[model samples]
Target: MMKKTISLLLMLCVIRSFSQDTTQQIMPGRQNAIHQQDKPYVILISADGFRSDFAKKYQAKNLIALGEQGVVADYMQPSFPSLTFPNHYTIVTGLYPAHHGLVDNSFYDRKRQQTYGMQDKKMVADPYWYGGTPLWVLAEQQQMIAASFYWVASEAPIQQLPPTYHYFYNEKISIDQRIETVKEWLALPRDKRPHFISFYFPEVDHAAHSFGPDSKETAEAVQFVDESIGKLQKVAAASGLPVNFVFVADHGMAKVDQQNTIPYPTIDTALFTINSGSAVLQLYAKDKNSILPFYENLKKNAVDYDVYLKSTMPASLHYSTDDDRYNRIGDIILLARLPKVFNRGGRPTGPGKHGFDPHYPDMRASFQAWGPAFKKGLQIQGFENIHVYPLIAEILGLQYDATKIDGKLETLKKIINTK
Candidate 1:
């Protein structure tokens, strides 16, 4: 009995020592590992309304060359309505239309009962006006900086710091001038360089809206944006600060058949307004109750459009929630499945029109990335706008809340050499 007790005590002591050592080994700092990784400077470029087919159809040598040097997605499916403001916001926030609070290009706030559009800079620029944290805000928080040539939320005063620098909306400005301004910023000293940068070209989207998607004008505009990307890349190279450019579009477009086109019913006092996308229509009603009748009427009557409440919106849209900061989406959402016109501003005299349909091939946007951090000759499956947000955050080496976002940075793991 004495020998057994001694053995037991020895074993107990050994076990206690092992446990203590293990406990010390895994103390707080052990689990609190800081993953410090080398990050790359990121530049995001948007060719408004440019579609995936443009890559195969148009001879965009610069874009194609960029793809050859990096990765190209089969398509970058946009969020709901595949419209401009919402989709662009999605790209930066990594959330669906509903979550990001930019449900559409134009929407009516039920609380304030006010209409909103990109042109409404005062409201749009308010950080409180948005829901998710854009990469710019994330970069600022991480002590890294960001810049923008002409992006939707770039000019907005968000958090304590917005983009380190940005150009307010200037419709009359030329795309080249925008590129030049970006170049000037890129020339800043290495320590002063922004970790992330974004540029938007609305010319192609404008041209597509003015002249149908198939028009020679639209094709020419694609080439123009491609050349613009080329020039920007050249400037970055000249600056000796290698930059990776991620080229994307807010949404794609499809030509509306005149015979098939149906105009939306005119409202009396305009209970709601709309923000046009390549194929989505985000409607906002002044009275939430009015939305039900309006939505039911569209579904029962307008068989051409796919309508849903913001809550009922499809998960695939990457915009499947309502944001407190941006809850202005109409009670009933109307998405045109067929190529048609909503004609909010009275039959826009344009050969082209978006804000209609997405599932269709013509409505799928494009994506391309090239630079030191990108893999050459790589191709990826088409993804959503939200994916770009995480990828941008990853490239800039900034931490972000992926939980709030519908996107993930793992999407770029194959393209970037983390090892």
Candidate 2:
């Protein structure tokens, strides 16, 4: 009994050590410069895997109401190979995944001889893995205060600068508590309050992956997010700040064929290293001389997928060798057809998946904006997600080098209320 008790205690200690941290992290001695004290507030919220049509299909009443008060896009086009980390980073940096160096959720960087996966906390937090000046980094560079409740790469001190007020990503904090924290930030003194804040929700993505995008569980998760946003808005209003809210999703979820999953194509392991995804697979050649032969073989045997050399990828994707600034993209790319996904080693797979080409309707993501800075009762055509960085930057009056980022402010400038 004593031995068992000691083992249980040890397990409890381990769990505590690894458990999510709910503490608010703040950078000391930081304040909004006097010039930024009067700037408008922008709260950027991302609901991962929230599809463009989910509000209407799942009857997200609160979101519908919010849309009626602001601008709604028909859909938001995610960058190529739509995935969470890549798209989220793309939205903030206004650069495509390849240009931003996040190329995929899981990718091997030949230069660093390192692999970056979303689940690897150390890799995810390493600033070396990221590129491009994120909006928060831009804001802080200009002495504007920024904060993040949760966002991709928010924990990383990119450019050696993190948001003035932030929290490490964790789900242990209840929705109410999260909203309350936002309220607290807004209630801070003029110079200490963050003018730009980012918030994120992972519930919808989690449910969709586990129970399929159309399942009741996914709908429930959507509703929860919808209600949570409503609460956040109410609290912000109570703070009496003109908070502009921009809601988006990294990518949409698709109900995929869980049974009879696609098998990994046979490859000579000696010559290649593989990074596999549900809808995409990348093979890095050990020798440049071996690439063409292996690629030709894969192309000939490719079934239910399309294979391409890095240079031959469609120009629209902006993911070809010309766009691979960091050399993070694989030498050979394999894109899985819809409803089919690669399941290596016959591992258990989820019913819902993404990371497909963004051109597919099922891969389009959500976008909505409301509050004082937006034109009311407006609906617009779909735009690429990169434009979002400029939108938020414009709203907060944050200056950025237009030449350094891909987003053009003109793409979203018309939606801002000039009057």
Candidate 3:
């Protein structure tokens, strides 16, 4: 009873503090609104599964030049539950997965009594699953054009508004086509072009999964992506338009040995729904009270991973949420201890996986931006990925509903030029 009381108190305190904060009003340092004719343009791209070191390790020329010419972070750390959909949204919305109600790339929403997983197209497009407003949504509200190649929550009309040039998520679109489309968007008259745009390339991530992160195939994919960057720049220069470019990755990858799969055949699978993430696992008990007893026994047989209850999750991850508002978060989360695979559910054991502890060095994402808005040759150490939202907002002078967000404008302002 005492422990329960303490946990409840802590949760309430967190809620109360968030409610009373400064997020209810407009931010103070917003720059002057963009003039209709010379509106600043920002193109943000995600190189799926691209690790931070691939630039230096593989000598990726265009990427290295972008870093040298503008602001580049040593790395951009991903939010907790470092899966693709969640972290991608976090980068645009400045909210952690828990706060945004995307507790997992796949999970059951207790409030709606429905399951939301990325695999189901209807569920993926369901607006209810996406709680926060992404950059594209807000961009439309401001009467500025925004386009998306493929972005989470972009297909749906979030807050009853979608990007002006949005399309359904299609990962198979060739990289050359993706580049050409964005160039075509920019080549349009200034008023017709998107003030903010996004592109997603899945080849690096796909190749890393099919082949280990260290394999020659993954290297080839990395090289191809670098060449594609050159193509994008060539098209942009040809169009005679001034643009800002920001490149990032959802999260890094880690190799999961297929030969050593840890299938937990002994546990009674009936007690809970085990959502296997390959590198991580989430457990939702049929009876909430049964969790404590199950954990006791489960700990006795535990190997190669650490288990965490909702209330006991690391404070740094910022993953705890008010269950009354949404209960999609797991009752128990299992994080694999480095380079281990706990594949009890017989899921596909791809050579590479993410969704581990965000603090893990291997799970760190990448961030680099080059344009007139940024300071030339500015390089800084790694920072959290959530800060990207405010940086985008600042560059475009966007006004959002958030009075307070996880992303701090001040933290990113150092990279901006004052004059």
| Model 2 worst lDDT window (10 residues) | 11-20
Cα lDDT, all candidates: 0.71, 0.92, 0.78
For candidate 3, give the lDDT.
Answer: 0.78
Clashes of each: 12, 0, 2
Name the runs in model 3 displaced over 4 angstroms.
Answer: 1-37, 265-270, 321-325, 345-348
TM-score of 1: 0.82
Best candidate, TM-score-wise? 2
What are the per-residue Cα lDDT tens digits for candidate 3 across 348-408? 7778888888888888888999888889998899999988998998888788755656788
Candidate 2 per-residue lDDT, tens place, 134-204, comes to: 99999999999899989999988899899998876678898888888899999999989999999999999
Q: After superposition, how far is residue 212 of candidate 2 from its true place, in Å?
A: 0.8
User: Best by lDDT, which number?
Assistant: 2
Residue 5 displacement in candidate 3 (angstroms): 50
Ranking of all predicted structures according to lDDT, beginning with the best and ending with the worst = 2, 3, 1
In model 1, how large is the Cα lDDT of residue 211? Answer: 80
The best-first sequence of candidates by TM-score reads 2, 3, 1
Error of 3 at 356 (Å): 0.7
Steric clash count of candidate 1: 12
Q: Per-residue CA lDDT of candidate 1, range 1-419, in tens?
A: 99999998986775444323211011011110123213567888888889888866878888888798889999988776667887888888888767767767776666666666676545666665577888877876676657776788766677756777766655656667777777777775655556688888887888887788878888898888888888988888897765888889988877776554556655534576564543456666656668778777777777566778877877655444444346666555667665565554454446666654456677799988888878889989987677888777776667776677888877766777564
RMSD of each: 17.9, 4.1, 10.6
